[model samples]
Target: MTSLLLVEDDAVIRTSVSLALERYGYHVTTADDGLSGLEAAQTGGHDLLLLDVMLPSLDGISLCRKIRETSQVPILMMSARGDGLDVVAGLEGGADDYVVKPVDLPVLVARIRSLLRRTTIAQPQPETGQVGATLAFGELSVDTGSLEVRRAGQRLELSPTELRLLLEFAAHPGIVLERATLLRTVWDYGWDGDSRVVDLCVQRLRKKVGAERIETVRGFGYRLNTT
Candidate 1:
């Protein structure tokens, strides 16, 4: 059973979502406010967190940052608004994914499962037929066998999604990786996947990998300029 911590302020939403999640075979633990959620998160046994963006004492974004300071536990943020800023803020605050309110249980469950899968996957090993055993682009070095990345002699703290995106770029340096291809490869998204996720993740990756490493292809998608 997958242990989950749900931090939601709304009474109806908390109860309803908890029951729905439990029916889907998850072991759900609920917290009604940010303080308690933070405390529960610190206690640290849950496999994932479903955090509401609005709460008392501490908002979801702040709580997410605080938790990130100590844990890399995958987080899925929930908000009533679909505002671009809210989504980007949640992702920037260290959330792995976000879903707007009035969330359809099925879709929410699918997202949860995907995030869990990403977290649980073992670090990849380099295979003979793989893209590359090791790759170096400028000062950046990536060891595919160990799933390690080093730049300028310093290691970067990247989420699994971020690491995968970087690896995809390294595999095909200078190739314009279409958003649709990235969605399928990095996010495992089907035709219905949102391209915005790729854009947001690319923005985040640029912060770590340096903005010059990835080039926006204007009307197309993105290309990794190894030069």
Candidate 2:
């Protein structure tokens, strides 16, 4: 049986979710606060985590960051409503997906299955050991295998999405990669998220890797300057 941690302060919601998940063959562990949930995740037993955005202690975003710092255990965040800010916060905090409340039990189960499927396929990434075989572009260096980027030997912290964006731009340096194409290629959104998501990630990446390293063409997409 797959083990899952369900962290929600609402007793009714918690019990219902637990029973539903149990019926679906998941052994669910319940927690009423963010701290307990974080402890459960840190213990290294659960296959997945179901986190509530609000709780009595600590917010879901902070807990998510703590969880991601060590474990890549798939996290699915639940919110009171489909608030975009909450969803984005969850995502930025390393949650794999978000679901709003008043969700169908069957749909929730399906989402859990989908998230687990992705988690099952995910391989552990190698540690950032060596920044070798570096692809040098002007003052920027991207080390693919180590997944590190540096400018003038100063390390830059790139989120997973930002890193993927940097790689795509690096691969096709000096090319006018369109917003649609980049959304499809970098995010695998296949134009679903379109420019907004891609553009946000790109903007963050630019801040990390340095603005000069990435050039924004008016009414067009981005490119590595290759200066």
Candidate 3:
């Protein structure tokens, strides 16, 4: 059974979401405050974390950052406000995805499933049929079998989402990948999905892979620079 750590301060939301997730066959451990949530997250037993943006003692963004410092456990953030700044802050703070509150249980479950799937197939196989195949883009190297990425020979600490996004770009170097394509291929989202996830993920990937390696093609999409 998949286990989850849910951190939310609202008693009503805490109870309802926990029960709903339980019905979906997840083992949930709940924490009502940020400090407790942080403590539980640090213990490292859960497969994923579900966090509410507002909490006592520490905000969800801070907790997300703290968790990211040592772990790459999939994180999904829930916020009452869908404001751009709030969404950006959560993503930049290390969350893999976010959902607006008045939470739709079905949509939330789909997001959870998507995130979980990424973890299972985090290191996708290369097309060469070679074990330990490594693909190079300039100074950046990705060992698909080993699930490792090194830039200029230095290993980069990337979240699973970042790693998968980088691999997608690496596979089709110099070709423009539309956000819609990326949404389906990388994130498993359909047409109605938010494009901001792709943009924010690209921003994070660029910071680690070097900004010059990826080019934004205005009004089109983005491409990985092979040179």
**Top lDDT hit:** 3
Which segments of model 3 are wrong by more than 4 Å? 123-130
Candidate 2 shows a clash count of 0
Q: How are the candidates ranked when ordered by lDDT, highest leading?
A: 3, 1, 2
Please report the candidate that would top TM-score against the real structure.
3
- The CA lDDT of each predicted structure is 0.86, 0.76, 0.90
lDDT of 2 by residue, 1-227 (tens): 89999999899999998998898899999999999988888888888899999887888889988987777677888977647787777776777656789657876786687667555333336666654467989889987666668988998755445666687888888998888887666544422442555565566567767788888888988888998
**Model 3: per-residue Cα lDDT over 1-227, one tens digit each:** 99999999999999999999999999999999999999999999899999988889999999999999999999999988557777788888989998899899988999999989888878555567678769888998988788899999999999888888888898898999999999888887855677888899899899999999999999989999988
Q: What is the TM-score of candidate 1?
A: 0.89
lDDT of 1 by residue, 79-101 (tens): 77566677778888888788888
- Where in model 1 is the C-alpha error above 4 Å? 122-132
Q: What TM-score number comes out for model 2? A: 0.62
Go through the candidates in order and give the clash count of each: 0, 0, 0
